[model samples]
Target: MPKLLVTAFDDEFCDEVVKVLGSKGIHIHGGNRVVSIDGNSQVDSVSLENGSKIQADMVLVSIGAKPASDLARQPGLRIVENGSIWVDEYMRTNAEDVFAVGDCAVKRDFFTRKAAPVWLASTATAEARNAGTNIYGIRVLHQIQGTISAFSTQIGGVAFASTGMTCRACQKEGFRYVTATAVAPDRHPGMLPGASELKVKLVFADRSGIILGGQVSGGFSAGELINMIALAIQKKVTVRELDMLQIATHPLLTSAPTVHPVINAAHQALAKLRAVGRELPPVKKAA
Candidate 1:
């Protein structure tokens, strides 16, 4: 029998991708690297480093792109270790009056301030706007500092999106964190047309309750939903504040206000923090 295998790095987003694709009859061979492709006249199969062979009529490889910095190098522009043009926060190159943006420019991590290999059109657009406005001088007081790595995609009729860091990433980076998840129908009533179960998972700092990341999986709304989470991460919103957020909802358009997935997930995180006897930031009383 023939099969489709998708090998990917072990991460929360890729795990969700595997689950969604698996439900649609696609197999995922994650955490396995393909060592070689065996063929005669046409493509035959791929051999995994673990001594496993996957029969394949075709192979689709999706390695990430490398920055083409040859042009920038010609002018003695500083190139980072990752083969991308070194650029400041305003996308200005080391050369006088020269700027680089998009995939060719290096990006830094929002939290770590280290060089990050995140190349996306959305990130590039933000860089371009900053570079354009600051061409003459540093007119823009506030500017993009680093890449958040917000990403979203649709697979098997389900929209899966994530922003900021994942639990695995937190562990690897030695961050003390807590996570919580909630599920609710996208529409107020489960019987509404096009209603889908929206699942939300949130990660927060262990004691401070500061939101570190979020993941959403559901209908088309998940795309915008992840953007909201990205904003929350950027603003360093705490679980308590997120849980108390006021939201607009309608029976046909959104889930019940009482059971909104994002808010509920925050509530769950707060409970987890409390259960662990972690000291949480005091909530400010509205004047």
Candidate 2:
């Protein structure tokens, strides 16, 4: 088949497709995004805007991002470097009398232990609950994990999610990352999605080989995949811990926790880590 190539910033689906297509001898150019092969193509790139050209079969724009922050304009809020509002653990904004949540407020990075964006709805809700509760002498018993935070998302159908950082994310932060991926069926029968596939990619820090981020896609819903991964990130789950997950699965429901897709993906990430000669401790039991 003269297969068409695709690109997506949140592409856990494309990877599985490419694997299937590769085995079938289908012809497709796979990458972050498909660049136009012919010169007679419209172009767009930060570098391209500065005068650059890319020749390829087609161009697939996969920019993974969203609304940054608008805290800087807040009359009373302290604007941080990235235009995010500085908030205390209770998510209190500079006004002290006020609190910010979601995209508006800034939280600390779990990895670098620095102030950063906690823009996910998951984080937002948690911060909001805390901010609201804490506003009137309410003390949240759970001290939000500082420095490291996690998030999850599903794409193109199959469930995919990640916690912590991605290889690309780590590189931007000047941190060395180790990664692994697990490819398997979401069902025990394996033929349920005879036409469907599941792919998981997990990235971790090379220094500590700690689970940083993950992406999964396949079957029906991938949101849960990311959720579990987020927990892994919040608890700083190591590949070893993930390897020992006790996931509940109903062939039509999920992968066995003993061999959960997410956990397996961690194992895969572990292999990649070892290949680089980085010393990673045994997988920690899932908390």
Candidate 3:
């Protein structure tokens, strides 16, 4: 394994990934920029902007990428700063009868409503379907205003997943939120064969109790668990509602009957919200 760094918007999730990578004897140089890559035709060393260099036989330089909007620009279409074609919620471009989808199209954050730089085939396909359905007029009842950006990755067979926003993002966007984390065994009895620990984190808005986002890391089930959370965010599921969410549990497939990590995390947030409510000044009854 060589030195690597994974940079993203989610700080806590990135920290968890760094720990997982560290456990696998992989060093992560996070929050640093690659100033130069000293390599020939094959490979060489890499230097960072922070006066640090990593000697290497082969280096993979993946700084970043922007949308290739050259073709779209030829038709005099609007382009954002990232060179992506500007499109409305229905993937409709400013030009009449012109539509854009996929990586070349602009994206917005689902919760924050800000211009998002997320590029994913899932988003692309969803946009494509919306655009295809609404070519003439608004046939679909809903349109994609922003992307939730659900994603999952694995390291050493340990899967990590996240959807929607993180606590770091909530703070940066000035959203009033409450967050909680819970860890439970993925399999019942805690001693089942192939059982792994599952950790879940959920964030909710303080006032409305709406779920903002969630993150999970554990066995292969982590991937699906994240999609559930993504759906919760999409449907505007509240913390109180999630705390009471019901699901069937089995010994071989899931955590203990008393320890569903997602519901448990939601319960923790609900508890905090109750405590905060107790501390607030109460209103006088209307006479």
Number of the predicted model whose TM-score against the real structure is largest:
1
Summarize candidate 3's per-residue lDDT along 1-287 as a digit string, tens digits. 12222222255556667788788998887667778878778557888878998888877656679988889999899998689899887888999999999989989889777778888888889999999999999798656868898878787788888888787778788998899999999998989899999999999988888888888888889989999998999988888778878898999999886989999999899899898882322322336
Q: Provide C-alpha RMSD values for all models, in order.
A: 3.3, 7.2, 4.6
Task: Give the Cα-based TM-score of candidate 3 against the true structure.
Answer: 0.89
Per-prediction TM-score: 0.91, 0.67, 0.89
> What does candidate 1's lDDT look like per residue over 1-287, in tens digits?
01222111125556667777888888877567889999999889999877999999999888668988888899899999679999888888999999999999998887777788888899999999999999999999657868888878788998878778778678878989999989999997877889999988999999899998888888788889999999999878899999899889999988899899999999999999999899888765777
Give the Å shift of residue 78 in candidate 2: 1.9
The residue ranges of model 1 lying beyond 4 angstroms of the native Cα positions read 1-13, 284-287
TM-score of 2: 0.67
Per-residue error (Å), model 1, residue 126: 0.9
Sliding window of 10 residues with minimal summed lDDT for model 1: 1-10
Per-model clash counts, in order, read 0, 22, 0
Error of model 2, residue 189, in angstroms:
0.7
Ranking by TM-score: 1, 3, 2
Local accuracy of candidate 2 as per-residue lDDT tens digits, 166-235: 5656777898776666767767667775434666777877778667777666655456666677677877
